[model samples]
Target: MNLFVEGFAWIFDPANYSGGQGWIVRLLEQLAYTFGATAIALLIAVPLGYLVGHTGRGRDLAVSFSGGFRALPSLGVLILLGLGLGIGFKAPLLTFVIIAIPPILAGAYAGFEAVDRKTIDAARAVGMTEWQVVTRVEIPLGLPLLIGGIRSSLLQVVATATLAAYVSGGALGVFIFDAFATRNYPEALGASILVTALALVLEGIFALLQKLVVPRGVVAKELKDVRQRSSRPLAAAGVPAQEGK
Candidate 1:
C-alpha cells in the first residue's frame, strides 16, 4: 500500500517526462516504434488482401499464412530475433507487425470478397478499368470491414506495444519493468493502468472513424426501422398538406 502511494506520487512528477528529465521519453520512443511497424505492416497487408480477395486467387493461401503467422508466439519470435538483432525495439516491432497483419489482411480480403459481384460486373460493363473497378467499386464496398480490421489492429498493437520496453526499445513498459525490478508494485500497477487507458482511447478513436467513414447507405440501412416508424405519422399528415397545396 505504501509502494502504491509512492508510485502514484512519482507518476505525477513532471521531471519523469522528456521535457522534464524523467523516463517519459521511454514511452514516446516505444510509441514511435509500434506505430512505425504497424504502418509498414498495413502497407503490405492491405494491398495484398485486396488483390487476393478481388481476384479470388490464393485466398486460402493468404488466410492460412496469416493464421500461421498468428499462431507463432510473439515473445518466442522476439526472443529469437533479439539474439540476432542484438536486443532492441526492432525485433519486437517486427514481432508486433507479424501479429498485427493477420487481422488487417484477413479483414481486407473478406471485405473485398463481400463486395457484390453484380456491382463489380456493372462497373466493368460501364467501361471501368480493372483498377477503377477495384478502387471505385470493391474497395469502397469493403471499406467498413477494412476499417474494422484496422481498428482491431490498432488496439492489438497498442496493447502488445508495452512489451517493447522489455528489450530496451523504450515505452510504457519501462515503468512496469523498472518497477517490478525494484519491487515497486505500485509503479507496476500504475503503468498497467496507463496502458489500459491508452488502449481504450485507441479503440474509441477507431469506433468514431468507422462511423465517419462508413457509407451513408449503410447508415441509412441502420436507421431503416426508425425511418419506417417515423414516416407513418408524417406521411399521414403529409397527404392533408399536399391536398392543401
Candidate 2:
C-alpha cells in the first residue's frame, strides 16, 4: 500500500515534470522509438505475409520465421546486437523490429487465411480483376484481423522498447532501468505503471478498431450464438426460454 501510494505520488510530483528528463519527454521518445521500429517491421513483414496468404506461397517459411522470432529472448538479442554493433540506436531498433515482426506477420497472413475462400472466388467470378478482388473484397474482409495484428504488434513493440534503455536507447524505459539502478523503487513502480497504462490504452483503442472492422454478419452470428447458448441452459432446466433478443 505504501509503495503504491508513493508510486502514484512520484508520478504526480511537479518536480519530475520539468526539462528534457521529464515524463512527457520520455513518453514521446518511447512512442517515437516504438512507431519507428514497428513501421519498419510492418513494411517488411506485412507485404510478405500478405503474399503468402494471398497466393498460398511461402507459408511454411512465414510460420517458421514467426515461431523463431517469437521464441527469441529479446534481452539476449539486444545484448548480442550491442556487443556486435555497439550500443547505439541500431541494435535497439533491430531488436525491436525483429521481435515485432512475428505478431504483425502472423496477423497479416492469418487475417487473409481466415477469410472464406468461397468469398474470394465469388469476387473473382464477378469479373473483378485480381487487384480489385484484393483491394475491394479481401482487404475489407480481412481488416479486423489485420487490425488485430497491428494491435498485437503495438503491444509487443511498446514492451520491447523498454529494453531499449539497456542499449542507451531512449524511451519510457529510462525511468525504469535508471530508477531501479539507483534503488528508487517508488519511481520504478511509477514508470512501470505508466507503461502498463499506455499499453492498456493502445489495447482499448485497437479493440474498438477490431470491433468496428468486423463485418456486421459476423457480429450478428456471434451474438446469435451467445443468445442461443444462454438460452440453452434455461431450456435444459425446464424454464421457459426467452425468444428473439
Candidate 3:
C-alpha cells in the first residue's frame, strides 16, 4: 500500500541518519536503555531467584511478588518516577529496571525448580559439595530456562524503553511521538516498523543463544520425550504414529 511504501521510504531516508537525533542515534539510545536495565535487573533478580529455588524457601512469596510487580503499569510507574525524581534518564532507567525484573526472577527460580530432583540427589551422592552441585550440575541444567527468562526480560525492556522519550530520555519513541504531534504519519509508521524489526532481530539472536547454551544431550532427551508423548495417544487408539525428528 501507499502508506507502507511511504513509511519504508521515510525509514530509509538518508537525511534522517545524519543528525544527532537521527534514527541510528535513537536506536542506540534505546538499546542502551534496554541493556542497562536488563543487566541491573538480572543482578538483583538472579541471586534472589536462585536462593529461593535452591533452598525451596520463600518461593511462594517471590512468585507472589513477581506477579504483583508484573501487573504494575510501566507508563504509570514512569510517570510517577518522573513526577518524584523530575524527569530524566534516571526515571526511565528505574522504570525499565522495574519492568525487567519480574520475568528474569521468575525464569531463574523456575529454571532451578525444573531441574530433576533425582539428578541433584545423584550429584550429592557422588560426593559433590553443595556448592559444586549447584555450580556444575544445577546451573548448567537450568541454563535453558534461565536464558529463557533473560530473553523475556530483554524483550520487555526493549519494547518498554520506547516510553523513555516521554520522559525526555532519548529513544526511538521520540520519532513516533514527535511524528504524531506533528501529524507525520509516515514517520510514525516508519518508527513503529523499526521498533518491530528491532524486536524481531533481538528475538532471533536470543533464540540462537538459547540453542547454543542448552546442552546437546538435554536437547536430544527433550526431543525424544516429545516423540514418546506424541506416540502414546496413537498407540492407545491402535493407530500408527508419525515419526518425530
Clashing pairs in 3: none
Clash numbers, per candidate: 2, 0, 0
- What are the per-model C-alpha RMSD values against the true structure? 6.6, 5.0, 4.2
Write the number of the candidate with greater lDDT, choosing between 2 and 3.
Answer: 3
Q: Which stretches in model 3 have alpha-carbon errors above 4 Å? A: 225-245
**lDDT measured at residue 228 in model 1 versus the true structure, 0 to 100:** 38
* lDDT tens readout by residue for model 2, 163-239: 88888877788889989889999999898888888888878988988898788866664465453356677889998
| Candidate 2: residue 213 Cα off by (Å) | 3.6
* Candidate number with greatest lDDT: 3
How far in Å is the alpha carbon of 163 misplaced in model 2? 1.2
Error of 1 at 22 (Å): 3.2
CA lDDT of each prediction against the hidden true structure = 0.78, 0.83, 0.89
TM-score of each: 0.82, 0.86, 0.91
Name the candidate, 1 or 3, with the larger lDDT value.
3
> How many backbone clashes are present in model 1?
2
RMSD (CA, angstroms), candidate 3 = 4.2
Per residue, candidate 1 scores C-alpha lDDT tens digits across 164-218 of 7777667788788888899877778777777787788878888998999999875
Alpha-carbon error at 47 in model 2, in Å?
0.9
User: What would the TM-score be for candidate 2 when compared with the true structure?
Assistant: 0.86
